[model samples]
Target chain A: MKTKQELKEILDFIARYATYQLGSGVHTSRAVRNSRRIGEALGVDVQLSSFQKSTVLTVLDPESGEALTRVAAIPALPISFERNSDLSALSWEALDEGLALDEIRRRYRTLVDKPRMDPIFTLAVVGLANASFCRLFGGDWTAVGIVFTATLVGYAVKQRMQAHGVNHFLLFAGSAFVASLCATAALRFDCTAEIALATSPLFLVPGVPLINGVIDIVEGHVLMGVSRLVNAMLLIVCIAAGLSVTLLMVKDSLL
Target chain B: MIVTDMLLDGLFAAVAAIGFGAISDPPMRALPRIALLAAAGHALRFCLMRHAGADIASASFVAALVIGMGSLWLGRGIRCPMTCLYIPALLPMVPGVYAYRTVFSLIMFLQSLDRADGGVRYMQQFFLNATVSLSVIALLAAGATLPIFVFRRRAFSMTRRK
Candidate 1:
């Protein structure tokens, strides 16, 4: 009994919902499931095809045999587990409460608009984490201290460059270069110089994308899986290239 | 002595998880659980490797399984998705050394292409390190997702009101 305009609006909302989930770093399978769940709550059937750069969503009015599809580009958003969790919960809430579209939209807006962790706090914590990574690799206190300072400086640069909308690969490379170069200060001391250099850029390893790629492939979303894996591999290569530059400059002194 | 080492391992891992987990901006309430999962999982891997003579990849798989299960149960309490808890906890166990060695060996292999013996040695090193790194990474993902695969209803419904 829904009008064509109503189906179109639902299609549009589904497109944004799916694309935002994809952009927020969920694997394709989860995005599809959550989107379909929301569609079910709204009394429509949604068929979603997700890609690395975009998603195509089709909303079918089973009662009337009318369908509308929309292709929306997935925006590049920072990973936020809080958003991911809340959005997934929102889908469930819609289903459980039989919530209306307007209520869902209102909740979604509030969820996404929540403030994220401060960049300075995240930077400091990541520096401490990378330093601990050095210790796990058997670095001495001196090397750990070196890595801590190196990561702080490098992550600050990454944060600043990211704010300016730099290419991600270049941002990763620039950060790694700055971090490993700073870590080479261990070469001047009697500490675990190699470990310091090795672990300085550990923070830049694309863990989410790499793991999510495998999850996607295993779950049969092969196209997006391969794209994500390729992207993660490229980032790893960029990190290595950055470190190699530092190593080349300090090769003799390192040994 | 062994207990002390494991304790230190867990302590460092908790700190590492909290720090790295923050990067992805997990819910503030999830931090303590993430730390606990990371500590328990990393410490278990350390114990298995140091005491049980297990290889790195296998130890990681076991540890990741533990983390996966822990996250599944813990996530329900907080009404968060299991991925939000487990992924950051798994970060501390990533094989940084193996990955670095793989890239380093690849570089050496390319550089020594004209020298047959040197090239052969570096090529062998490259494959070995790359295989280990890939296996560990793949295994970690497999182990973590296995719980979800088994308990699909619970995993997907953790955010639902009980």
Candidate 2:
């Protein structure tokens, strides 16, 4: 029922949607699966290839044997599980109800533009989580208080650096340095400085990427897995570099 | 005293998972499940370490396996991706202390490079800490994802359904 040009436009939008999902940190197979589901719903066949920083998607009209291929360079975006869930749900709806292309496009646009969580709320939760880690590791009330404040300050710095579009490595390093430095206050106050220092930067650990890297390798996406693992290792090194400065400065006192 | 400690640890793990779930911006509906999974995993690990004398790597592996299976089941029940449930839940088991110690010892080793006795000790400590940290991370990933592979057909069918 649709002309070739209109179908091409739909395929392009689907490719962009797939690229966005990939960029937002969904696993390769899931991204591919979701994109194919949407394409099939609209009566097309989809093929996807993902690399470290970009994705290639092709949609084919089986009846006419016409194909449209799109290569999108995905700029990094902060991972949001909320958006991933919403998009997946949207694709399912399209498949079940046979939604029109215009309606699907409008829904996709709204999903992408959904407001993110409040920055203040994010800072507070990260701080609380880190502080909880301190307690779980046996820090006393005073140490928990110190770690809470330290994480709050550190996470705020991280948020600010991200807002300014600073380099990722530097942002992590700076946040770690600030966190460890502030955690020293626990020592000054006779609290458990060791626990505070160890836990304050727990929030900065890239748990998702580390897990995703292993999953990718296990699932046979070796190149993507290796890249993700290397990136995570580099970030860990940056975090250590930042924490090392604080440790060196306060070496004598702590020792 | 041990029982109380384990209970407290589980409670903290749940709270930490909730906070992390919020920070990651998962759907509000998913937070409770994340908290429950985290608490369950952390408690399981703590029990293994305290009662069975399991090493950090083995304990983390078992705990992560539990969390992974739980995530799959829960994700299917809730009709969302398994990752939305698992990543935040697994945060509590990340071995932060070992990682920090690995870095600290490595730095000390580098600084004492010219020294004979202390440098060797620092170097040994660095290797020990790094080995433990890396092993735990590796095991965590392997154990958590093993179920997905084992139950591949079920996983695929569940996700593919309308």
Candidate 3:
């Protein structure tokens, strides 16, 4: 059995590693800043070090000049004349007094699952759609209903093609186009009171996250929130690009 | 059928909450346990709302507090920096819907080619509904802190006795 001190050390290491990998995936800068702050606040006394992507380079402590750790985060490819290197911390350690392997595995799994099917995010999208649809066609959800159904179909198509390594930007644009086309067709053809339903999905696109990002900026989490907002807006821009192609192709008299 | 809707909503909310809560910390045994706590919270909130007509925000807060305090009794539950699953999962019931409606309604008015007066009326409608709903959610979240107070007081008293 591992001693209490040994176990804590392992736990601390796992915690730091998990946070590092996940942070790199999302906001790396924020993670780096937060980690540095946490270390300062906790008064952790371990020496910190960094290394360039070469065999003999190491960052020594400013005061002691002792090399802390050797690192090789990025490797160079000798292809193009224009090549660049990225810096990364190879690893760090913390002493968690009571950590377990099973616990680490369990936490890792949960952390991985969050970006997928997170209910609040989905509900937020749905709620915004419901609200906007009701407002636009209050007691008149015809065309929006068509849009909603079309969007679902579009989503289904995207999912199916996803396994074949389809470009996500193109997939999303195609889905939005299909939704818009469905609404447009319903309006021009049967005059079914389903336009609201059809257009509903189009409206569901990144508006909420965009607005949220803006709110985050206003609240001064400028980088953290706005980057999220920008990503959402870019998705919309991709969809709009897809939609404009179809819209411009048709005659002005289609109204 | 109405009961089914309410139950489904609560159940979905619970599943999502527990799942989300387990995200940041204390990975082991968080979901099933958090689910139970969420149920108890909802039940308490339901009773409070029905019998005492407690303010909506206050009711939500009290219920959340119940869940938080009960977590201690459950033994070695997760501790996290942010609100974790509670806020996000609780968000469905957060009156965000009302806030959304408020904005959407105003947009419709602005889009309309009709009388300006009608547009203003919709703008008012959305804002009023949003205010009431948001107020209720905020109050309940606040009231939920009562359990924390009670827990702290009990701890203090016990320490004094010790």
The model with the greatest TM-score is 1
lDDT of 2 at B138: 94
Q: Which has the higher lDDT value, candidate number 1 or candidate number 3? A: 1
Docking class of 1: high
**TM-score of every prediction relative to native:** 0.97, 0.96, 0.44
User: Per-residue lDDT of A1-255 in model 1, one digit per residue for the tens?
Assistant: 579988887887888888888997888898999999999999999998888998888899899988888889999999888988999999999999999988998898999899999898999999999999899989999999999999999999999999999999999999999999999999999999988998998899888898889889988999999999999999999999998888778766753
State, as a TM-score between 0 and 1, how close model 3 is to the true structure.
0.44
The DockQ score of candidate 3 comes to: 0.04
Residues B44-73, model 2: lDDT tens digits: 999999899999999999999999899888
Query: Model 3, residue B8: what's the lDDT?
Result: 43
TM-scores, chain A, per candidate: 0.99, 0.96, 0.51
Q: Which ten residues in a row have the lowest lDDT in candidate 3 chain A?
A: A78-87
- DockQ of candidate 1 compared with the true complex: 0.80
Candidate that scores best on DockQ: 1
lDDT of 1 by residue, B70-162 (tens): 999999999988889999999999888877777666776776787857688878988998899899989999999899899988988999986
| Positional deviation of residue B46's Cα in model 3 after best superposition, in angstroms | 3.0
> lDDT of model 3 at residue A89?
16
